[model samples]
Target: MLRRSFLKVGLAGLAAPGLILRAQATEQPRPGSPFIVTYFDLPGIKGSRDVTDAGDGTLWVCGQRNGTLGRFDPRTSQIKVISLGEGAAPHGVVRGPDGAAWVTEGGQNAIARIDDKSHAVRLFPLPAGRERANLNTPVFDKKGILWFSGQNGIIGRLDPNSGKMEVFDAPRGAGPYGMTRTPSGEIWFASLAGNYIARVDAETAAFTVVDPPTEGQGARRVWSDSKNRIWVSEWNSGQVSSYDTESGSWKGWKLPGDKPRTYSVYVDDADKVWLTDFAANAILRFDPLTEGFHSFPSDRAGANVRQMDGRSGEAWGGESGTNRLVRIQTVKPA
Candidate 1:
């Protein structure tokens, strides 16, 4: 395992002078747009990927390419980077109830816990024979147990208190990519290769697969809205769809422009749907009430933001290609 170290960086003292300002210079949203966009260049984090609210006005970001995790404070324009371990390519991160950052540590094939206060790193490797499970995402159930997915046909759970872990085969052979917890306490995951979304029984670990309306839509990620509806980003179909878990109905909307490749989907605190489109190089916000889409294209080409999470007024994502963290502050429409 690799040794862990913390590097505190302030934008003012960065060796690459004016790098953050240069990134922000081109980030202005279109004129009259109700959103203000800002970009922060991550000093040492390469592949700044999946991000989640760290609960204390900061965010936890996965440094996939560089094998690290970063705690970013927006107000101070500072970040604290913590190394995971040798070959530790973490994919997804979420702030757990314990105020720690729980990571799907793909490189180590283990679950990692980063203490919020101490910046301590702890690993819980999977049971034998589950090597290279390709861990992707993790979500916590109502009972505080952690559930996670693997691209290599595995669904798993961990009891943080007991230090016990369990892994189960997914319904389809592979492609469990993103997982989310609904307000109703149900867990749902999207299968990128299997092209379906499924619900996991928190108690039994049984999976009930749900097919999207479009075949081969390639459901890459899912987020639950306030109504408990599952919003999916279809990579193959280039559409954003929502499933009404209660009504058993579905709705799909194709993204604007040609060859749109929807990579991630997030439902904001106000129930607004946020999506990242590869083709347009933009972050889109979909208003359910008006059925309209607003685009916030990145000024730079290939801004490929992978995942997003946020608080009440802001949506945050990592610009994996650019190695920057982006924040879009939403101003409510009168």
Candidate 2:
């Protein structure tokens, strides 16, 4: 595999005489291993918090600082910015079945959908008398239903066609965070405050919450693997866990750093798991087949990478604190 390393130097330091940023050596790819890293510096995208692939070669990114939306095309390397209105406080994003991009506006207690072609925006408010929406992560099921987690201990669903809405109560103070749908159409979610992984049956509307194997550890994000197992990131415990849907069993791996604050968890097409260490400013990759681990740090400190999505041997995420979009391209084994 051909491996390369690149560094982003600050303008102030680079303009001072002959000073140059040191080139950190890239990690060597082992035999039968495939992965590489490519970093893109997104200007004016401070607080890039979450990203979703539009499935048409476009990437939609959300901002934490000002609730802005950005569109990027890998082919053209062009980025366009769209304001999500003042105080939108956008978080997780997903492409709805209606072909619009749906986002959780944590600041506004509502869900908004953006037309993919026109960029027209429409807002859907939470049910009357419901607590502040604190709407966070969102995902769409096969039937065109959009589901999202609210910080105020509830899961919400919206039918884009009819604008009908439903809310399911979670345990008090659960703080439901990221969510994903399984092949069976069940919605799996992580609870940052409740410390569990939950599943909601699409047909029956029943809910199940599974305690993490590590007691007292809060799950910040969740993703379903190809094998039908759900993976979760233990934010405070610095660990990753897997729950077997068939056997109702659980297993976990402790991250390298203590109290690492693992913010996001994703499994690529090859079944390898990837995690973001917010405090550590690094991306960690774990190979389930080999049980081996690899770590890559960001070019800049205080990056605070929050969420990610993977596609075509590449992974993209937003740096919430720095307001930048980070990209990593994996170099396949030779």
- lDDT by residue for model 1 (1-334), tens: 1112221211111121111212222366557777888888888688999999998888889999988888888877778888887788999999888999999999988888888887778888877777899999999999999999999988888888877788888877889998999999999999999999999989888789999999999999999999999999999999999999999899999999999999999999899999999999999999999999988888778889989888889998899999998889886535
lDDT of 2 by residue, 1-334 (tens): 1111121111111111211112112332344545556555555455788898887988888866766777777666566666666566888888877667888877767777777877766777776666586788999888888889987788877777777777778764657998988766778999899998888887656678789889878898999888888999988888888999889999888877756778899888878898998767888888877777798778778878788887867777776766666666784535
Model 1 clash pairs? 2-86
Clashing pairs in 2: 34-332, 34-333, 35-330, 35-331, 36-329, 36-330, 36-331, 45-323, 46-323, 47-323
- Per-candidate local distance difference test: 0.87, 0.75
The runs of at least 3 residues in candidate 2 whose Cα sits more than 4 Å from the true structure, single-residue gaps closed, are: 1-34, 331-334
Global lDDT of model 2: 0.75
Weakest lDDT window of 10 consecutive positions for candidate 1 = 9-18
TM-score for each of the candidates: 0.91, 0.87
Q: How displaced is residue 304 in candidate 1, in Å?
A: 0.9
Candidate 1 stretches greater than 4 Å from native = 1-29, 332-334
- State, as a TM-score between 0 and 1, how close model 2 is to the true structure: 0.87
- For residue 298, model 2's alpha carbon misses the true position, in angstroms, by 0.7
In lDDT terms, how accurate is model 1?
A: 0.87
